[model samples]
Target: MKLNLFFQLSAWCICLCFSPVLAQQNYRNNEDINKALRNLVNNHKSHASLKSLTKTLGGKDVWVLTLSNGKPEAHPAIVIAGGVSGNHLLGIELSVKMAERILTNYKSVLNQTTFYIFPNLSPDATAQYFGKLKYERVANAKKTDDDRDGSINEDGFEDLNNDKLITLIRVEDPTGDYMPLEEDPRIMVKANPQKGEKGTHKIFSEGIDNDKDGVFNEDGIGGVAFNKNLTYNYPYFKSGAGEHAVSELENRALLDFLYERWNIHSILTFGPSNNLSVPLKYNSDRANKRIITSILKKDEKLNKHISEIYNKITKTKDAPKSVTAGGGFFEWSYFHFGRHAMSTPAWWFPKFEGDSLVKAPKNRKANFLKWAEQEGIENTFVEWTSIKHPDFPNKKVEVGGIVPFIMDNPPYSKVDSIAIKHSEFIIEIAKIQPDLKLINLKTEDLGSNLTRITVDLYNKGLLPTHTEMGAKSKWLRKINVSLKLGKGQEVLSGKKRLVLGIIEEDSSKQLSWLIKGRGKLQIEATTPHAGKQSITINL
Candidate 1:
């Protein structure tokens, strides 16, 4: 009877643990994220722990959730990061949901692998979505002079239509570079002079020119974007790249933590820069450079392989528009930090399917507008309404456009499916990580208390022991093999310690140590990313 009661209580506890998910609707706020993380950690205390990396300028904590079965530092680790770009709300949700899924469903995998998840990095800017006025914000709460006018946040967005939304404001001007698309007048496209098209409107963020600099919303609220503030090829003096690379407290904290954790072999970042749906190409010219600005040839092949796995696992066919990574975390993880880094936004707007005779609009906004309308998604676009602008006096100006964050993120109801697929893909990647083994052990007895120990060290998994970039970097630790001698044992020949470079998948190396030992000898092979294995031989 007591056992039955215990089983009933366990079922009740499981139901209570997931009750918060049923109540979830919109994207979580900072408070909700904190609560969710706390609940997940408490529920999975045996394998998970939560800690704050640092606090942002807005006093929001940048939290790190770690999951492992044993000492996490000893196992190969994958860093799953999100909210590198604040406006990409889906990234944070994916990160948090993936963590929860892993803990709840794939907890057994933690025995060989460790995961570090930073669910929300730009908490200050992300909080703006739940604020009184909503707009797409990409930076943290630190004040910035984006226009370099010697004033911080002097000019920002305004809800000109009094709708509490910061959309777009377009002014009718013949000399403008923007023109309405032929298919959808609600969307604007750049005029093509070669096509005999001329611009009829000037587009700006919904705001009056508060600084009177003839520019609208140039210097907006918040500061450097975390996604833009990284070390690899830092965009110096460029807007949103921060005063310098690794400047923010959040970036510094993450880097400081990552540098010490040598077991981190791969990074999966949820952000604007994606290489999973579309793999990065190998540029031979750049790859041959002394500075090595391109992905190494072998690494590019691995990327393609991983992309195939990602597409197959997710079954997603839509290809997102390609984006460059300049001073971005994903690029830094590979080029500077020397780890296999993969990034994805997890979801994007599927291609609109209309009559082929309709001739699709070249403008992205128009394409989305038409698609949203066909799907009966209401309130996605604000109808253009005329408004008198303070900057462009006597000019025809209007406030209207697509609502912020709607285009990038799907509805909350669709998140569970996307998260499940992504979690499956991540698990596939973890399963393929390098597994080192010691095989074919033999000991040959010789006279005069001498013995020979022979063993083959092999990488039995599909992935290499270390990434190509990791092998190139002196910072990454190499695979180490050492022999521990019994009492009164000395090395007669062979290396007592051997440091080997990148061990390709299914590759093996045979080593025999001639030792002057009395009874038994031990050999151990270890790598930060591949874990460690040992064997003992009696002579």
Candidate 2:
């Protein structure tokens, strides 16, 4: 009996050691996510607070978690957003997990930097992953007519093979625009007319043309995509981009919350777009244009520096290039919102390195399949099965393709480590936020009870107090330096209060003032985003 009890106690200790890993064995649904968020606030009430910015059309709460030791607006802030794309479930997981890890281990950093985490921004569409008929959905549940055919969701996807999964359907035809790649026949690629490639197969989303408009699944369920519903470079009249920019309730809610928070200096998003692994290049013409499309030269330099830090901390390499689509949240955050914005898909299929004799495939689909096979990931691809279709009755048609959401999100077992690396990266970034300091103080005793006071207002952190674009934007607050005089004191020379421009990292500006009379004078430098500093001197 004594031996059995000892063994039981040992087993309990082992379980405790691996509890965190075991708990995250699967992705959380909306209910689970809400409960987990509530529990986090309950457990870490001192440093973490949870609030719902608004409810989506699907009746899901768009939650934002604010993490700080003191008043959140009093310190420099970074906004970490996730689920910018509904198909990327890993993003939602990363945002929530990063918050939990930060509050648990890196709680000390909260004293200097505040974090506003918007996890699962596309909750309405992300919920479709857990729904029965799963596909790579991007839009919310606002009921849109995507194709503008005067019909609402009439040509949505159908489970042609009764598989309960929305895969692809291919039909053999002479005039087809798509053809199977020679390297991997399982994958399809657009036929290149310039390369003398002949088309043999036509592909469409697994569905029939219910509207009889010759388009299959053109208008699906759901409405605006949050990533494509922002104000910058909006894709007008585009599917999933909404009727206009900031049209959705979730979009308006997020922007309203962001506009109210003057302390947010930078924005980081976990989604399909990536600018962290490889920084964006600066184009002189684009930067000089009236609208300013490209990243400013100084800001581009900062992006490159931060990219190096991200690659070093995450050790991520050979990331696939992702283009910033019009109206993307990633671009809007920087171009229009005027903050230091950075985004990453957070995960991707690592580059396939074959032996000397075996050359890797060039096509993305072929490469992903090769990696998936090596990793022993199963059920990722559905085998092609012949099915009789109503649309193409004469031609031979089949349904099969890579499963939805798997390519963008890794298996659940790998998420914890991914979350840890991202959490570390975020903490490192917070440590380097622009910190204002008053240094190099000097005082001279002038004749006739007059005194000369000199000090250098310095930005000691690694990042500039304002991003180059932010400096030009009227939305951001300027750095204000003020001299508060004691009783019977008057300024004789320099202005009592002065507004300053951008302060580059590790740079300082000297300010000298002549006072007619002084007892105890206080000098204070304040900025909503860079933080505040003050000092007192006696004469």
Total clashing pairs for each candidate? 0, 0
Q: RMSD of each candidate?
A: 5.2, 2.9
TM-score of each: 0.94, 0.96
Give per-residue lDDT, candidate 2, residue 436.
Answer: 93
For candidate 2, write residues 278-348 as lDDT tens digits: 99999999999899899999999999999999999889988988767788889988988889999998888
- Full-model lDDT for every candidate: 0.88, 0.91
lDDT of 2: 0.91
What stretches of model 2 exceed 4 Å from their correct place? 1-23, 356-358
Query: Considering every candidate listed, which one attains the maximal lDDT?
Result: 2
The list of candidate 1 runs beyond 4 A from truth reads 1-23, 356-360
Give me the displacement of residue 125 in model 1, in angstroms. Answer: 1.3
How far does residue 13 in candidate 2 sit from its true spot (Å)?
Answer: 14
